[model samples]
Target: MSITSRITGSKHTFDSVREVLAKANEEKSGDQLAGIAADSEAERIAAKDALGSLSLETLRESPVVPYEDDEVTRVIQDGVDEAAYDRLKDWTVSELREFLVDEQTREPEIARIRPGLTSEMVAAVAKLMSNMDLIQAASKMQVTARCNNTIGAEGTLSFRLQPNDPSDDVENIRHSIREGLSYGVGDAVIGINPVEDNAERTKRLLDVTKEFIETWDVPTQNCVLSHLTTQMEAVRQGGSADLLFQSLAGTEAGNEGFGIDVDLLDEAYEFGKEHCTASGPNIMYFETGQGSELSSDAHAGVDQVTLEARCYGLAKRYDPFLVNTVVGFIGPEYLYDGRQVIRAGLEDVFMGKLTGIPMGIDACYTNHIQADQNDIENLAVLLTAAGSNYFITVPMGDDTMLNYQSNSYHDASALWDIFDMGPAPEFETWLESMELMEDGRLTAHAGDPTRFLEGDR
Candidate 1:
């Protein structure tokens, strides 16, 4: 009936029993005895419940804590005076359209509210504007130029040469690079996520890539998509890389899981900036996306989109040369379908560009999703028309290594041709020298010269 008797099956007091156990064995045995006593107490409580001797208290929910507003929210709230915002909100849709067309009236207000505007509001406003007006608005939002100034300068295009082989064989990777460059890709950056992630392999890949860059004299950079720590290790071991790369999340724990903290990131950035051989705005490359916060269990009650924007703020602090939002790579639990994916992709680009970060879209989808290459094309075209910085073009627009399909090298060429756009300045000059471009048009050297139809080819 007593606690000590219930646990130890002996007629000893609890304190005496604990002291005896501790003396006989060690402090650990005493702790075990304490656990037995606690279990016995729990059983007694359950016995009382069986006898209907327990009283119940009414349950009350805790107060909900409000999210701490971010700088973008605070800035927008401050810039749009309450009275003006209310009046503007009440204006007829047509009146809003006309106001948006007038640069003097629209730019100031739009810039203020743009950070906080919902996707629906953006879509509604976009529906009323002409193509030219949309392009102009996107241009006004540009803060940082990226990818050798071609992206923000002249709607430049580029792709990722993901030699995702497990061995990371030098010959295979070299062939892929040759093929991509032969078609005028890599203007943005020829980045690879090496299958075997280690300092030696990454260094080998970078060395081979540098050799190709030098051999071909292409005006582009090479990146091995490894963790920032691994990249730093490679650099320290005398491995050459043009850019340091990592996938970053919004929260500290999430970043720490990837072996990076803000201080580590700053160190990597400084090292790349000092050692970079490529011609670009900056030397650090970062990849981020929505759902990563939730996936990493670091969302902290903030919406995914807002958390993603905060990541951009973190990335901006380092002045990265490239910040790509791999919009749908995490799949449908966060985005659900193609419609959500498209909207999120647009919203990410808009937010990233507005925040003064060099932005690119890894307009991609997993096989398990309802999206496909067509969905990517739709987002890519819309973003391109809205002055997106760059895109990741894989072989045939399908990533054999990552097992997903994205925009292809041909897709980049098509967007250029349809919009009459060209590559970045330095890249364009290189392409002209290689005869990939002539008279502002992508020559046969830029794509399939036979121009075969889909089935015919």
Candidate 2:
């Protein structure tokens, strides 16, 4: 079908956009975007008068060697690559600064994609996109989430710690607190998902949130806590979406079990705004396979509906800069649908495109496993295309042999190095470009001993 016809077809309720366009035409139109200007080249030599006379002052000591040569210094100074050195030699300081500081030089930009196919799911995607954009716009800070629960006989786990102290594991709690505040993130979402009932879980979550705020003004570093897995009061928790809506729209509080209450969330937002000095810590729901694999259809159902709406609403409310998602808890089973994940990921990208939001993929798993390079690369490409520039997971090194399950937490730095999209320069090569004096001192001149593009300059 033709584009115009498709837009007006059964998928869309619009009978005609011609009238809308006509009305828009009748109204005033603002200034159009300016066209790119063409440049003219003129290599005209300046008259000697225009150039003015110039005198060069030689340094008191133009030592062949800029500094004292020591073994350590020599080692530090000998790592520059030929190509990089050549580039440096050709560049002036201001030019080099401009090159390094320019935004265009640092990161890959995914072009903006317009929102299409408005639906609950699309809206959610749009919101996530919006939220992600907001996050990227903010200063980068370390953010972490932690949870703990005491499983009850009803299959519903009572969230033990308040939002503030979910982890009884002192080490985990300390880690979460330190991680969040150390970088001044100051904001985080704490939630619980029940394995059984929603209402009970939510009650517990609220109780914990309240207790957390009252307990420690600041938490210890490296503490362990129970993370939330489910919230029963939500509509999709064995009931209709309507029930969830009613709950969100309902009373302020009664008692909770797991998950979040809309009223409580609002209260927390206010609390954070007033007391925490931070603006907002969002609410994110974590779900795992209820002993069932993630079918393409189920994936569609959530990505298309619940997740979409929830994120969109949050974006509209908080207008977060970037939207980050943990693609179902890290598990081997879901990896089966890697292809499906790719598809769903694409949908997320398109949705973000429409909303001008950037998204980040969070590979949340307890196992300290390194993901496959091909999978990581593909996901990175897909995410970048979808307007994401950040990832939330452990750093990784390029060890093709190191699978996610086999690695240990001690390798986090390596993992971080591998998984991160940021530019990483090798240490040894950085030392070679220095314009070294016989005495071995540092200098900024590209060929000087001090000029290391990649490292210990």
Candidate 3:
């Protein structure tokens, strides 16, 4: 009379679904016996005995389902449209591999599903692809193999100088630069964001940076990480800067807060070409990371990593001098923990390098996340092995102003020693000329360069 009785064909209440399933199994076992009765009793008894046995030979002889193959097909089919699914449903493994490589065919369209597709799905498809297909896709995506040698010649170390207080006077800021330069850092560029975010203060900071470069002849560039418009305003007011810096995102809306768009970025690029006096190959420095798309509510159902790659696509259009993935700087809400941070950092570097941009990693983490210096070091070593162009080196590995820890000067030194890398060619020349480097190693002056103070005497 009740729903349970109707389903079970008995007036019994199930305490849980497990009890109902157990009853159903009992009935199924009886049905199986009845079906087996069609065979001889001796045969049925032998079959039962074989199934009941735990013999190694019998277990080894049992049929094993190829669950991994089934799972890969399920994942691929799940993300594809029905029509696309139908087309691929009958494809052989060889056919699938060919489809991924056939440039003249529309097969790549099958891979262009909606953005919410999981990494597993992407990886599954990737697994089916050959190295040639992967390389072609990377090339088509405009992934770069190496960084531009304009700012830091290839294999050079670089660091950013936040200076704890952007409002610090020229002398105080000079002190920070002196310390970083003494350790053979910042050969790439000394990038700083103004605390005041005004044209006057921006110009003053640039002036101080220019003074330091001229005084030391460090053969490096400087960056002002304010809105492009602010930097342009400073330039119009007779200010100077080597690179124009901004934080960019994948989506239009995500970049709107910074008043940036592809068009605006183009305009800024042209403006920098006109105003920037640096002899570097490019003048634009853009920073990006995951979670910004979701943070701006502009993700549009796209996965964070894919959207982040889209940002790189946009960046490469301008032929940027430096592109940095500030992994873990935003916090755990997007990345969640150190494992996620490490993965994202490696992915960014791989994607960026494949996109053919001069890619770097701001291998860093916030306190709120399950990350520490060791985590950052792990990423740094991995990224270095992956051909990362540069990283952000701060004092004692802690950025007082940004409230995060990144690769330290010591870490950079270790990487140099371990990898036998040095500063960019131009910076290396200056270091050698200044006696900061001798025979491809840091001179004692690199640690205690009192030459900067000799003018006082």
Name the top lDDT candidate: 1
* Clash number by candidate, in order: 2, 89, 10
**Pairs that collide, model 1:** 150-424, 159-393
Which ten contiguous residues of candidate 2 have the minimum total lDDT?
26-35
Q: Give candidate 1 misplaced runs (Cα > 4 Å).
A: 1-139, 144-150, 158-161, 279-281, 448-457
User: Model 2, stretches more than 4 Å misplaced?
Assistant: 1-168, 171-258, 279-310, 328-336, 349-353, 356-358, 364-377, 384-386, 395-457
lDDT tens string, model 1, 372-403? 87899998888887767788887777777788
Task: Give per-residue lDDT, candidate 1, residue 442.
Answer: 70
Tell me each candidate's RMSD, in Å, in order: 17.0, 24.6, 15.7
Give each model a TM-score. 0.70, 0.34, 0.69
Off by over 4 Å in 3: 1-166, 454-457
Q: What digit string (tens of lDDT, one per residue) describes model 2 on residues 123-227?
A: 222222222332242212121222111111111101111113322333433343333222211112222222233444444434433344324332211111122
Q: Model-by-model lDDT, in order?
A: 0.61, 0.26, 0.60
